[model samples]
Target chain A: MDTIIIDERIDVGAVFKKNIIKPRWFVWKGRKYAITEVTYTWEDTQGAARVMHFALSDGNTLFEVSLNLTSLEWRLEKSSVV
Target chain B: MTRTILLIDMNAFFASVEQAMNPALRGKPIIVCGRGRTVVTTASYEARVFGVKTGMNLYQAKQACPQVIAVEGDMSRYIDASHNIQRIAREFTDQVEMFSIDECFLDVSKTCRNEVDPQNIARAIKHTIREKLGVTCSIGIGPNKVVAKIASKMQKPDGLIEIREKDIPVLFALMAVQKLQGVGVGRHISEKLMSMGITTAGQLGNTPLEKLMHHFGIMGYRLKRIGEGKDDSPVDSSGGNELIKSVGHSHTFPRDTRDISIIRSYMMMLTEKVGLRLREYGLMGKTVYCTIRFGDFTSWGAQQGLKEHIRQNREIFFVAEQILARAFPLSKAVRLVGLSISDLKPRDTQQFLLKEMEKDTTLAEAVDDINKKYGVFTIKASSVILSEKFGIRPSCGMVSKQALKIKV
Candidate 1:
């Protein structure tokens, strides 16, 4: 698997129920991909912004998406370009 | 009542976390390593079968296991998983002591008194971890900490052993002396005992205390206790926070370099890290310590004492830089550099004496708040960035956390 860094902002459809973030789908580069499974979830910070990261897979490929809480922005940080 | 201590040792922690997340590399031989570090941090059981071991460089690992897959480890992932596991363990017993990133000790004597079996707790922990986190842990339960830690390692991947108080003698008789690490016995001490025909824990325990003391001095008494599986150490939930003698950070160069600019940049970077940690812990120190290791690994270090306690990175770096410039051998290419502070005391909560002092404190606090919410290095000095440009990022090489603590 080859990893490609793609720090691009995207639109994510997610559920925030009881402090849990489950990303259902995201639109990146004009293509909407339904998240088949959330492989990994972790958290980080940028300055004062809490960022939640999720490694989402749409069956064949995996993409790491991060959401900055302060700005409420979703970004595609990187992807396992298979 | 005898304490029931359980040591939960995660099996191949970093590699296991990677496998848990990806799933594709579940059964394959894999070695988890950090970027720019050739040393393997953790190797999977499949890799261990091929003789691959932690700390082995990539070349040596490939030589041992040609098919081993190399994965760059993410510390945040492991830390998060560890936190979750610790949270789970606390559900059973409040006396959970985090031993390391992948290991912990639980004093279940109180919990067990409630009629809950230690084995059931261990089994439940194992089941919950495997089901929720996709990893397994080996748990060893004994009357004390030492035996519990040793027993945990007896089985791999997913194993549990409960050593009763009466089982010490029989168990020690069969166990090798070399197997005991960080349990009151040093390697050279073990070797010395072995030369005296003491090849097992039983033999070591049976050796005359007077004779052992005559040879090893004060440490001999501790060694004897370890040999008999007699450890009374409590499961300290403080997690060594109260035991921190100093907050320090060090980095080794990828290659030895005598460049003044690079050295200074790295020193400033290290000082920043130490200073940040000190402030985070609400600590102030009156002395600055700096060390330099040459190309041949011979080290030289010196400490500078300040008039007043300081926690600011700039102030600490100022002293650290002078100590390095005045003492370090300029002719020698530097392989590693370290910066630390001693004579630590809690930071004063009093109001600043001067307006400038208050301004500086406010600025520092604001920056810290911003970084805490955002991420580390979000607002760092330009010199720190220079260290990165020079290719000397923090946690640079084989200087593991355990290795760093050894020197201090």
Candidate 2:
């Protein structure tokens, strides 16, 4: 269960005051359901900064968010590809 | 029995709290604003269809929409989403009031005692802020608080409307004599009330409030009681509990600058952050004011008063560097800079007979105890670390601008 998408002018409270919260997912739509409010920023325009973790929820109804330390690429769903 | 008063507001609030947290910023456009180099402190409506707005700047909001999406303001995440919508507007009323930080008001006339329904308690406070702050608000309902803040901006983002008292003269006859509120009007009194045909707010409530006080004085008796929804004003629950006559800080220079030494090093770091929040609110003002804004967004502000009541950040950066050297005019290029202070008092002043002002209040209590234990500039004032090495500092608590994760 992973779906992260966030983008639009970043900063969900400076990415929840600089990330670290994951008790294995459950974040859905309306902006990954406001990732428990605040923290998010992904800059680079002479502003110099790039970071991630948008996992608000992907545990169903397809609502996920990403930014968990940049470098991303994924596609999996063969019964959670065991 | 006129008293329901809702208000609510929020839409486009920091781009709907950054599109409720970022479903690819839902239908794009955003903006947010204010981190320095000023203007545009709220845009989205898909960046107001590319003309972009809220105080403009950010280089004319990236020349009116270069794929908008700016974002900067946070104000502690909109004051923690206005303390979780003032904790669900204190479950419908302790007569709420917050009023700014994306507005709020409530009253709920004795908790809807005359049997609920201020438009279903503004749709149960917009479904308890969309099932607990997923965002979207609007709300309005009215009986006061200036017709519930003009029926909470008349609607957008989860609207609710209400007006009553026989729909205040058909909603002040389809609004607009500058949306008839306080008629701050201008654009030359909306081109002299649209060349005297006076467009709307029912033709300025049928004109003659003595010819709008013979051409606007006392803002034409407050635009004939804001075109008759008549305000009585109340709702000031003294959150700031008065006496802070002033204490300011301003910035607006993400660019445009004809440097008067970078606007006196951002007016000595916003008069050293309004003299460290007026010596951490022990207080002491005696006036100071000093605004600016230029690059055509026009703004000026001045104030003076002093002769004492200081709180020293080198006397509020030499009275905001002599009111930005006689209210600016080094022709163009400034973007903004402010630093208020105003009359206030309370710092229990008494120990003065002077010994070099008790060695400058023991060097401002040893630079406010090493900037409150190694935090702020950690013991500043060598001309505030040479005005933060020639100014514009305030990056507000950095941890490389956090973003480790939570993009959901």
Measured by lDDT, the strongest candidate is 1
- Give per-residue CA lDDT, model 2, range B227-342, as digits (tens): 67776666554444545566776766666677687778777766766787688778888888887877887887787887768888887788778777886557777777777887
lDDT: worst 10-residue window of model 2 chain A: A73-82
lDDT of model 1, residue A27: 96
Give the runs in model 2 whose Cα sits over 4 Å from its true position. Answer: A1-82, B1-7, B14-32, B35-43, B47-96, B109-111, B120-137, B140-156, B160-236, B242-271, B276-310, B314-346, B358-408
Which regions of candidate 1 fall more than 4 Å away from where they truly are?
Answer: B239-243, B252-258, B291-302, B305-308, B326-336, B349-362, B391-408
Model 2 lDDT tens row, A1-82: 1222233433233212344533233222233233243223222211122322232323223222334333432111111100
Model 1 Cα shift for residue B220 (angstroms): 1.8
lDDT of 1 by residue, B218-334 (tens): 888888888888988888775454545777777877667888888999898787678777888899999889988887768899998889999888788889888988854587888
Error of 2 at B330 (Å): 34
Residue pairs with backbone atoms closer than 3 Å in model 1 (clashes): A45-B374, A45-B375, A46-B374, A46-B375, A47-B370, A47-B374, A47-B375, A48-B373, A48-B374, A49-B373
